[model samples]
Target chain A: MSASPHAAGSTETRQVYLFATCVIDLFAPQAGVDVVEVLERLGVTVHFPAAQTCCGQPAYTTGFPEEARKVAAAQLDLFPEPWPVIVPSGSCGGMLKQHWPRLFADDPARRVQAESIAARTVEFTDYLVNTLGFRLDAPAASGAPLRVALHTSCSARREMGTLGCGRALLERLPGVERVEHGHEAECCGFGGTFSVKHPEISAAMAADKLDALTASGCESFVSADCGCLLNLNLSLEKRGAALRGQHIASLVRARMDGAAS
Target chain B: MSAASLPQADARVSPEDFKQRSHESLHDAHLRQSFRGAMDFLVERRALQFPDLQAFNTLRKLGENVRQHALAQLPDLLERLEARLTELGVAVHWAETPADANRIFLDIARRHAATLMVKGKSMVSEEIGLNHEMAAHGVECIETDMGEYILQLDGDRPSHIIMPAIHKTKEDVAAIFHEHIDGAPLSDDVNELIAIGRRALREKFASAKIGVSGVNFMVAETGTLALVENEGNGRLCTSVPDVHVAITGLEKVVDRLEHVLPLYALLPKSATGQAVTTYLNLITGPRRAGEKDGPREMHLILLDNGRTQAYREARFRATLQCIRCGACMNHCPVYTRVGGLSYGTTYPGPIGAIISPHLMGLQSTRDLPTASSLCGACGDVCPVGIPIPDMLMKLREAGRHSVAESITPPAQALVGQGSVRRAGEVLAWRAWRVLYSHAALYRLFAWLAPRLRWLTPAWQGGWTASRAALKPAPRSLREQLARRRAGRTVPGR
Candidate 1:
């Protein structure tokens, strides 16, 4: 609709079908809103199809495959192919793109459709850097650079293999400084039903994640998965720790708004 | 020593014990720190072994192929192995269960009137509760491996398969030795501790009536047993005594000698990151008629235990491909934090999580499958390319009858297989399926959940315990989308 700021911005029409994950849809609506706004500000049309509900990760990871198939099959017709289906969370994005075909492996015809959807689905930050090619070269800032750490969820790190894309996003934010924690490869322990089944071990792992992030000397945190956000943010509150984790979409949108001025 | 006189474990593993152990382990600051340091060292050592990911994956493919092919022809290879070993003057015994294996060992020791028995690092022996059984029969058994010896002195089970005493620090080992050793003082210096261990075991090796060790790989084509070790004590346990008994599960056999080379390269590099361990002893047979050293008689015990059960099923057959490297546990976040004893199983961590279910049945090991975070770190690091996370999911499914029946149906109901079932938990999952299946119900629940956010339950297990209240937003995203499309000025906007 509008010309993008990129020097080599393509003249072809672009659109992003938003798959606002279940965790963000119910728990943190602001993440979904921020994701849509950041994409809109980049001169791309963002569509939030009302028929979409969830990507069915909660039951799938918790050893309920039949239930997962029922829920994941509902998403096949919600968005047509050719347009990239951008997802806010890497965990959900991986479920749609990487694991959907696994759920439909028993059937050949549905598996083809699942693979087609998987090829077009992209996580928000990955689409931001790799597809859109949006770059920030010392963009305008509203205040001093905010020191923050990034907590990459295990699903995002190992399953989706998108940590490099997450890093590229952090590097593009001119006013946002990224700090690396020691145990970056470890899980935050909010493993779907695992957090509910084994509480003590989950709390211990969350405490370790917080300690590593706190020790890295960051004011706050940003993560790609809302499951980690809900767990870590709550754990931080329980301990009365000043640290809080925001969705990466919120961080990127806020920095983009300041750059627009 | 008859089968009627066989003794079971004094304190059998129970599912309730695991819950208690995990609670205690999570609270123990000392145990947590020790496991953290030890696991970090192990993981770092293993990472240095595979700087090239492609090369590592290629080697894993070869290892997996060898194991799958070996298991495909297990019965034929085993028969070949017995004939070859018999020709080499080695006694080959077949055991169908832990009780049978123990009885065979005790009968052999009694025939020799063995008083003192020396042992190397053998997880199979621990799996069958052999040390305690031998001690009950009035045979003095001493653990010869340093880690096993320390655990024996401390009256503890081996926490890790490869590094049994890894949970103990230098100071902890020193204190354990100072309490148990009947000798001069040894400081915290590791070399001094090794010397003390070496000196204490040497006399036992010289005077022991029999020695026992674990086999890493038993070549079926030539009937040679390959023992991989870094301590050099395995060589002593197999060669120093008048009689040597090398015990291992039937899954340890490979088709040919060359099939063992890929696994040998994988085990040490995965266990302790050595290009080749200090000792790679291949025992083909007993000492010849005029040999100056080595055992006078050698016995190889092929214990089935529960491997035959696993080998019969295609779903769990991949579990038999393990090489006892312990890399899976080293990379597991849960095992490292909770330590090994919390599992209350002979083998702990990822491999234990998958294998113990088949060996001991699902009733006792129900908690092991749920212990992981499903991080896939262990699966990624497995040298033989065992899909550990996928296997963990299978165990979780088999642990519950309601879920397993729903997936596989009642016509093909799993028989003789043990599973742990909870009625209330089944009702919960049933409710979950009902809620997620229908979009209208999901939307209605989403609409009400946020408005009733204050009524969020505080008793959501670990969720609300250490985190803030999980209150949903006042409005759903679909609600916002509808208002925006209708040309309404959203309050936030």
Candidate 2:
């Protein structure tokens, strides 16, 4: 697996900024911890900038550009070391890489700073598969067989173009089988404020997604974004169903630990 | 045809009722299934046609460029189109508003004393409330397209742009036909239902004094109106009557006949997954001297209806590039679940969300832009490469802010600017900006939230409605990181 095309030869010890997205920071801190564990085990030093608050996706996507710009500007100085900024969630990483430059389009100084930061920003799964060559096979892959559906967030699919990174990482795990679900490319209806603004429609979409994943007969699911995991896990919990989703970071970390044990 | 057959009162489907309508639609299992099935089918068919991703992207780029070029020289091209059409003996009318469009239709109907006017499927006509206006003035406008004819008979608005009656199952259509049309029997067979509709529309076409249709593209160089349809009704409506009135949004004009080919190629494939539609009527003039069959007189109505307002800003000008393929809706997860009628507008789904704000004003369509999950499906599948999600975000900003507050104010404010901007929501965002932009404040808040997790509320506004309440984790990631960096193992891990 380490010799695969997705594997990187540059796994020499390197320091990188860890941007535990606000969603994972507050509600799913274990996922954040797992992200750190996964990175560190792969011969990388994870630096968590305490001042990092958010990637400003909620404000930006909710149509508050001024607020979003100000919030995004706050984090521009955090990753000044020229090291790669690893964001576990593709949604937040996309905000940094794709939208931050647009948000600061009129301000040349901030735009340059934003572009520099964006150039170094990479989603956790992409960094693992593409940069770190962290594929699991043989000894690492020997574990209790787990079946899971992979839900790629819209940002991962469309913005950052890391749609295949999660699947690639999982596919290399010999004991794991990725179950395909209906409308696999569709959204999970956790579009930040969109869920609250249009609850009925959002819930309806979430319900359909849940049905599709359940029908796939996967024991659980994994996604690279916390927003989607929160939406799906909570909905599953509400329905008193055992089918739930975990962040890809947490899933990978657990799989590694299980193999070691 | 009886005037009573037309829908009464032109109350533009108000987005104010969007929440309620969507609630009803979400609860309607049949409607949900119908939309899901139909959208899935359309999406699969379109995917089958575009096997090579690179080829599809290249064609999409070309389609986008053609539309953008046409719009860049829109004023010049429109004038040239009018000049060429006038030389061909086709009357050209420019309408800046829906009222202006209706007035032109009424005047033309009166000139021809057109009591019976047969229409091809025209979303523009729906936008201008043409059917109601014509009926009010004692003119019967019969929808000749099968899907539209079904909707018209049920006094129901179109739910989908390409497939108007998509929300209705075959049984529903059978019931509609059985009750509405005299001597019509109930039948769920697709061919039988289409035959029944064609039979009814044929008689209407024969007696109609005027024919009305929508243009897919208008070529300025050759003075041609391009119409694409699966049904032959668009051709019939343009040629069978003594007079033809073709209406289209002003944005449809292209510089030449060649420019129309790329857009034409993408339209039907993106629309119904067809390599080519059954009828492609290119009307250069009313009729030539030796023409066997065509309308004697032709009138082309160029409708603005808020399109000029959209064109004023480069950010939203992409809205005009839409070829009305309805591919956006077909690929949208939100549209698939909620169905089109939930939008409460002439157009529905992703395209409708962006364009309705311009067409009907932000006040009436403020909620429309927020209807999507920003899934990016619409933008991906768009034949002409309309950046629909970005346009929606722009519309959202326009709806929530005043002209002075806009990051880059347009030359003129959009219609109903700041219509949805409430003081409470404004204050909430302001507070959010405060908490997020200040690292110290955000850090303090993040620390306190998990510590005070016990005090979290059980019922979050809409969050707890269908999902379990989201509670703060025992410790935030920052706290864990701090402890780890301090050379102390985190308590939990």
Candidate 3:
């Protein structure tokens, strides 16, 4: 999954497929829009394949492999071009990059296709910091500094190993203070179906994560994965807490705009 | 003492009530705080031990490779171990079930006419209900390990594997000792409590006819049963008694003595964050001709129970590589918050979740697999790289699909396969697959979801309990992207 950033940027036709994950599709479309705007600004042609739907992570992680395979099979041929497939959510990106090969291992025809596509799959923040080398020229504001807490999803941290990529992106901003919170590496407990399956346990985890982020005295938070954003932000809203999480795509896009202005 | 006269546990906890148990455990602030602190301490100690990430990864890989190599030749190694032990005058018994192992123990006790048995901390003993079995047969089995001894006195089951009484504070332990032991003082002092347990267990160790223990590594080449512990109770259990019996899972055997070194190197560090345990007793056999301080008779029971079931599956074979290090639980987010007691199984935490379904079957342990969030913390810290999350996912699949629907053959299917397969859940997933697989259907639904966001339910079972209700955006990403392609300004922008 690691291609040289210079090689990525120097490509004559630097076009990529945007796998705007299902969560970002229905709930956080602004994140998808922000990602598109940022990539266009970086001179990368972002193609949103209409055929792409779900990544089948929900079914796969929920133990319905057969169902997951069917759903994953749909998107196999959507990225026919030999271009990088950039996913906004690490969870969905991981399902494509890591699990897709295994999901189609039994089928010889799909196995080759899965592996080929998997090599091109990259998380959004990873593509930004590594491939594009896009960083903020200055802080988001010359006024009061933006105190932000970055929440890295477990999938992003362990599976994708893109926590550093997101952290680097945010830390580069002169005015964006990336505050460290308690159990920074721990999960936010928004494990797709896990949130609904064991609600109490999931709620407890979200509460702790929210409290830690709030306790860090950050004005807002950012996460690479929208699932964690939805889980943490909604939980904070439910608690009537002022702290909330934004997708890294939206946060980075705003920072880039601020620098440009 | 008749078999009927033995006291039973006050409450026989079952994994069937995992949801309820976890709910209650989550609500207990004291229990939550206790486990959080304990786990944090253990996690920190482990981090300190493995200061160099590169070295830790290399050693962890070596440990995993050794176990994997052992597992590949498990049958041959086990046979060799049995032969070696037999030659060394150590009675080696193969048990296919928990009952078979307990029965063999009973037969040995009956042969010796034993009324008392002293035991070191043995998870296999717990797995087989060894103490209750011995007590039922008029043989009193005393737990010599301070933590287990405290739990035994309180009539409580072990929550954590290594730290059995970790759920209890020093004060709770002191109270239990004061109430159970005759003329014992109620003191929360750690040394005093340990002394009280030792003073009580010393008499039992001296008088007991049989000693019971769990082997850490059964070295096939050397015919040695390597037992690791901190308090020296394992050495005392095997040496002080006339007859010593050590039981372990069939998967514990390694091909050589050298193989145990790497595993042993990783075991204590991964388990209790110690460089090495206090005692590493390598029992070759019974007392030699000149030896005066060893058991006269030695027995080793290799219990299969449900391990063979797990070993049959290639993916699940990794589950057997576990050294019972308990590192997975210490770093697990779910285990740290909920505590081990919530599992309601003999072995709790990440290891328990993956292995319990095999032992107890998917029907009873269906909830255990799903309890975790598939967080990779357990897998990251597993001493042998068991890939616990993958194993849990496998179990979840095994438990959810019917025999015919499952890829696994009927004969090779997990016990109680499809036990937790609810018609509603299956239907829901099927519908999800249908909708998501079709591009037009998915887009339509995606568009409709946000457009009708107001119609979204206020209540969504457990999802809305601690979080606001999930509402879709005003427009779908696909719709917005389509508009952008058509050179139109997006409404939100």
Q: Supply fnat for every model shown.
A: 0.61, 0.85, 0.82
lDDT of 3 at A185: 85
Maximum-TM-score candidate: 2
2 or 3: which has the higher lDDT?
A: 2
Docking class of 1: medium
Best by lDDT: 2
DockQ metric for all predictions: 0.59, 0.68, 0.63
lDDT by residue for model 1 (B402-426), tens: 5346554333333334256577766
What's the best-to-worst order under TM-score? 2, 3, 1
RMSD of each: 3.4, 2.3, 3.0
Off by over 4 Å in 1: A1-9, A141-143, A259-261, B1-10, B13-15, B402-406, B409-418, B488-493
**CAPRI tier of model 3:** medium
Interface RMSD of predicted model 3: 2.4
- Candidate 1 per-residue lDDT, tens place, A27-57, comes to 8888888887777767677778766777877
Error of 1 at B451 (Å): 1.8
Model 3 quality (TM-score): 0.96
Residue pairs clashing, model 3: none
Model 1 residue B483 distance off true place after TM-score fit, in angstroms: 2.4
